[model samples]
Target: MSASPRARRMTGAQAGAVTARILSAAVGGYALAYAATAFLSVYLPMERPDRVSFASLASFFVWVATILYVFAARSAWRATWVPLALSLLLGLAAFLPGGYGVRP
Candidate 1:
């Protein structure tokens, strides 16, 4: 069955929201993966190989969760911003001076 006319025609605002949601999911997934891996690498009291293995496994779930959360949020705007804010915060926490891998 074909889609209804209403379903086929998307407004500019609706299109923009869809695009935002997609971009948010992609970027949020990447950011979440990176941040989670970095965090596990630094904080997990395990050997380097073990830490890397654990981080890699955890990052997959992080990416999946980010995508689900972004799509499930009531407001697309919030869906975009919340993950971005979390990405920024976690990224900064993982990489800042005196953080995980700093050599100072």
Candidate 2:
């Protein structure tokens, strides 16, 4: 026999977890992509066009990896905090004075 509707439906916590995972995938993934591209473009020792192209490709991979990591994490807290921390670190590295492009 088929289960009742209530039995098949997700509980409140399950729904919240799903929502958190989706938001993490969207926002966290974008943050990771942007930070990675910015850092790579500045740090890589390549011509401008080549560096940009490489950074763009690398950002795509970073974004995908972020999404996968968010879903695979055991808890939503880790999924959110880890990427947030990494993005902040990368942002600091890219924007700090004498960090990337500053010349003596």
Per-model clash counts, in order, read: 0, 0
Question: What tens-digit string does per-residue lDDT give for candidate 2 at 9-104?
Answer: 779999989888889889998998999998887788999888889999999899999999999999988888888889989877776845555722
Candidate 1 steric clashes: 0
Q: Give the TM-score of candidate 2.
A: 0.85
| TM-scores for the candidates | 0.81, 0.85
Q: lDDT per model, in order? A: 0.83, 0.87
Name the lDDT of candidate 1. Answer: 0.83
Candidate 1's TM-score reads 0.81
Full-model lDDT, candidate 2: 0.87
Clashing pairs in 2: none
- Cα RMSD for candidates in order: 3.1, 2.8
Best by TM-score: 2
